[model samples]
Target: MMRSRLTNAPARLFSTAVVSAPKPAATRPSSDKGGGGGSGRDTLGRRLLSLTYAKRSAVITINKWKEEGHTVRKYELNRIVKELRKFKRYKHALEICEWMKVQEDIVLQQGDYAVHLDLISKVRGMSSAEKFFEDLPDKNKNRHACTSLLHTYVQNNESSKAEALMQKMSECGFLINTLPYNTMLSFYISNGQLDKVPQLIQDLKMNTSPDIFTYNLILTACLPQRDVETAEKTLLEIQKAEIEPDWVTYSTLTSLYIKNSLPEKAAATVKEMEKRIARKNRPAYSSLIGLHAKLGNLDEISRIWEKMKSSFVKMSDTEYACMISSLLKHEKSEEAMNLYEEWKSVSTSGNPRIPNLFLADYIKRDQMEEAENFYNKMVESDIKPCYTTWEILTWGYLKQKKSDKVLECFKKALGSVKKWIPEGRITKEVFRNLEEEGDIEAAEQLLVTIGKAGHLSTEIYNSLLRTYASANKMPLIIAERMEKDKIEMNDETKKLIELTSKMCVSEVPTCIS
Candidate 1:
């Protein structure tokens, strides 16, 4: 949810109604349609998730349910959209944003408009995003909207545009908060443009007091250079400003200590992280578990896991994924396997990420057999793997020079996925191997899968076509298909066609016929 700037905040459009008691024997009507113990809100969440799965239009589906007498509060819609975004279901999320735009039942707030802008930016493009901002009424074009657009530019690393936008925001008197500054500073840190950050910090201090996020960005700037001195200086500045470091601050410091090879400092920072972890702060505990794993503090990792299991808190998908990843990182494969089994037992729907952590770790370690074994088990149990999983296996097989297994995984991948961005270097290496061998059959098989998935481009198609033409057969068929797909052949593709023609001529019999 977006936050509102002060004074320009949206007006409350509705009021609660006072009611008199109906009768002594009467009970208040339950909002739940089933009149069961479950909260209507909980049911609404499940219903929304189902709607997403069924590929229904979120706005239409939800409005239909509302018309049928189901309760769909505005706040619940916010929560559902947030959750859907977290699940990477952007299609449904954008629909809800569209719904909020047209729904005239309530007054639209600055935060609402910000959410709308961000979603539209993601689904559409920069032009649409600018149009959305331009279309907003004057009152809505204050700090939140300005910052929302600023965030879009900074996120994409359009540095000149972001800076230009920030300058415009200041000129319009809409730079009323430290948030946009913090965002730009964070962007600078991300791009390793730390030198430009000092001026921004100075401006932030002069105009408004910097928040914890600003200090955290300063801390992040020290990470790439392993500048512990500068990191300590930032911490001192934070303390001087009477701002106590929160979890993010401490987490950044912990990373700083880890990177700087100061184990004791990192250990102390983990203690600080633990203090912030209330019993139900599963992510906090998860972070601590991962930190200890990094530090090789296996005992602490086990202690935290034991605490989580003993506590009354319900473990989330994030917690399980974190703990599993931590265990694998620390070489506790046997223990990780046992924990994974427990997770599977509790999670009926299964978690793909849990297995992926192990898959990725095994791949990194070059333990191809183990990675394959784990992947097979996941498939056997009906837990669907994502594209990255298949890409990793394909990459591993390519490294081992197992062309057949590489082709096998590529086939399996097409069944489960539509499009995925593979590691460019590894994919190219595989292309090179298949091309040199003139394995036209294997090359065609892969080309067809990714082609239908619509991942083919001029560069990718050229490489594959060159390989097919190397075998001196069916080059025209592939070329014709590429043309049908509306892929414009580049100069490189033209050269490959010419080379194949010469090869075909050289192979022709000299005898008259």
Candidate 2:
């Protein structure tokens, strides 16, 4: 289960060597007799899945499959592409789509173009995807493509763009189905725009019938507002629509009941959740375990865990994480640690998130030794530390008053994350220690890194100035740096700059140089 780190390249710039001119058929692999279903031999899908590096191209695999004289069909290719997307192999998926487009013998359907467009939005950017959509022929700009672009807008939190796209979709009469509406509802609920759900539901009823997914999200919207009455009404609406509620429906209701302090009703809903749980649906099991824990039914958690073990031949990392998290919540650290060891033995994905959970708990409990040991274990096992890992370690070092280690971990934390704003309190504490230690160089590095992440605040700039002033050093280009960072100079900043100037002339020979 070694995973490839995902990287985004231009979707259109795939390998053309194999795609444009494949090898002779005589050089075809002798092992691939008939590359059809149910043969159980090595297939193209397996080869594509085996690629564990971002730089490797799926196009090479497809071209090699062609050169091997194997039968290739659009359906098979589409299936492989779908599976690749499911595994978060967006670059590989887009490569397959790109190869399909260049095939003169094959004609892509509307759905294929839609998937390609969606992948472009992911691998490239929204603007590229928008251009792609705009260039599509009128018929190809069907519900799927429009909805795909709309989904991109929602994902990017471009609310105005999303709304405009939805309006256009309605005008094009694409609202006859619930898919687009479901995407919108998901966007609204996730963005905390709960008040918009009812109106959207009204629009949904007017246009198309609400399905189980629709009502499930509607129920989810009710939970945060503690609106049990609305949740019940939504459930009734589901019944009227003759749509059976799924596991998520029951799970949301169970949570709502718990939130409203109707424990008996929550208990009843938990039973309903169990009835709806499909044998292979792991999320349902996780939800049920969480609900049971919320109801103070500790025994039920063990029973559910056992049931999950029996149901799945192998537990996924997510399932392990969920169970570990639930156990930790109930003060079951010993049991959680046991599960962590079990997961370590079997886990293939070097995901840092699971390890971060234990690191967080250990740091929270002030068990720095255990936290350090577990973190070292993760590093030994090739589980690269994510931002949360470093953040947890930083807090642990903060607790120990190890200023140097705290700043070191803080820098690593910032480096691990793509886009993050440092917490004001943590930043303040780190700078205070940095100023005391007179580590002007370290303070400057942190400031530059924070500025690169687009969070160089006035307070941060002031902190840096204070560090320089306290160290009897002059920040020679302080004015230029602040102007460039667009940090407005306050009275304190002016005073610090003036004071440091005097100190440089009077006391500090190094600063005068």
Best by lDDT: 2
Computed on alpha carbons, the lDDT of every model, listed in order, comes to 0.73, 0.79
For residues 360-479, could you state the per-residue lDDT of candidate 1 as single tens digits? 888788999888898899989899887666767887888787888998777666666545655567567777878887776666666666676767778777777677676775454546
Clashes of each: 0, 0
In model 1, the runs with Cα more than 4 Å from the true position are 1-129, 152-161, 191-195, 360-373, 435-513
* Model 2: lDDT to the true structure: 0.79
Model 2 lDDT tens row, 1-513: 101122332222221111222212011122322234444567886777666676899888888988999867888788777766766778877988999998999998888889999999998998788888777776677778878888887787887677666665665566777888899899989989887777777777777888888888989898789999989988887888788888899999999999999999999988998998888676788889888888889899999999888878898888888888888888899999899889988988787888899998988899999999988988998999988788888878878878768878997888887778667787888888778777777777778768777898788988988888778887777788789878899888888888887766333224223
Stretches of model 2 off by over 4 angstroms after superposition: 1-36, 42-70, 102-105, 348-350, 369-384, 400-402, 417-425, 428-454, 463-481, 490-513
Clashing pairs in 2: none
